[model samples]
Target: MTSSTRNRLFALGALLVAGAGLAYVAFGNIGQNLVFYWTPGEMLAQGSKAYGPTIRLGGVVQPGSLRWDAAHTHLSFRVADTDQPGAPSVPVLSSETPPQMFRERIGVVVEGTFDRSQTFTSSRLMVNHSNEYRPPKPGDGPDKWKTTVSAPTAEAR
Candidate 1:
């Protein structure tokens, strides 16, 4: 109605109810979908604060730290702040097959949870890639459809 008092009170009540619904939604479930991205160093610095939430850990895959199970079904690797050997590293375990582009000393981003034991259990693995297209090797033979397998190079990574 055009009545100002009733209109104002109804607006205030609706605002309060909407706010409460948002808060309830946040507390009940939306929090799980709120993924945060962090580097190995930043995650390590969070200590206990970093555990339990789904996180997208972005960093370089540590060279010589990648291991695959005999069946190749499980993969374990350490991610570092940089390609440097001694940078802060976060141990990751993934049951999912890694992207075809997965390799050591390359940029990668893994999504999963950081458990209390200090290891990140990844449900997803992704390799960081360049945005521009570069010519393939001069004599390189036909690969797997350019290995449309998400295989990438370290040029712009």
Candidate 2:
């Protein structure tokens, strides 16, 4: 091969190696960063493999479910699908302070891992108020009060 061709080939090989290295770096870290969400039923189905893997538990906050220690600031709660009638739920324990919106019947996303005893130890408590805002009714208008209406007086001349 000529000198120019040899240099061109060398550059092409370097570019290919750089591209492969970049691809590996990008894809290799994805599994570590991505978190999977699962319910108690699904986690039970997967058996012990689900243990020690960081994941999010998505479910409803069970009513009257929070028990917190005022002095120690320790807290615990149960999560379930409130919409599904009589569905069994999972218990979550956390030492961190829960979000303000974290209440019964609300949707929550808890992140952590489980142990051999099947207890889910949550490190983070994220309340999900994922509902989109709806505009007020047209005629039943946005304003709560009637500004145009006047209070009745004794004499209007």
Best by lDDT: 1
TM-score of each: 0.64, 0.57
Can you write out model 1's per-residue Cα lDDT over 1-157, one digit (the tens) per residue? Answer: 6699889999999999999999888787765546456889988988999889888998998977777665657778899999987899999998887766677777889999998898999999888875866765777654643443232332213
Consecutive 10-residue window with the lowest summed lDDT within model 1 = 148-157
Clashes of 2: 0
lDDT, candidate 1, at 81:
94
- Residue pairs clashing in model 1 are 144-147
Task: Tell me the tens digit of each residue's lDDT in model 2 across 50-84.
Answer: 88878888788676665655463667777885636
Model 1 off-target regions past 4 Å?
Answer: 1-36, 138-157
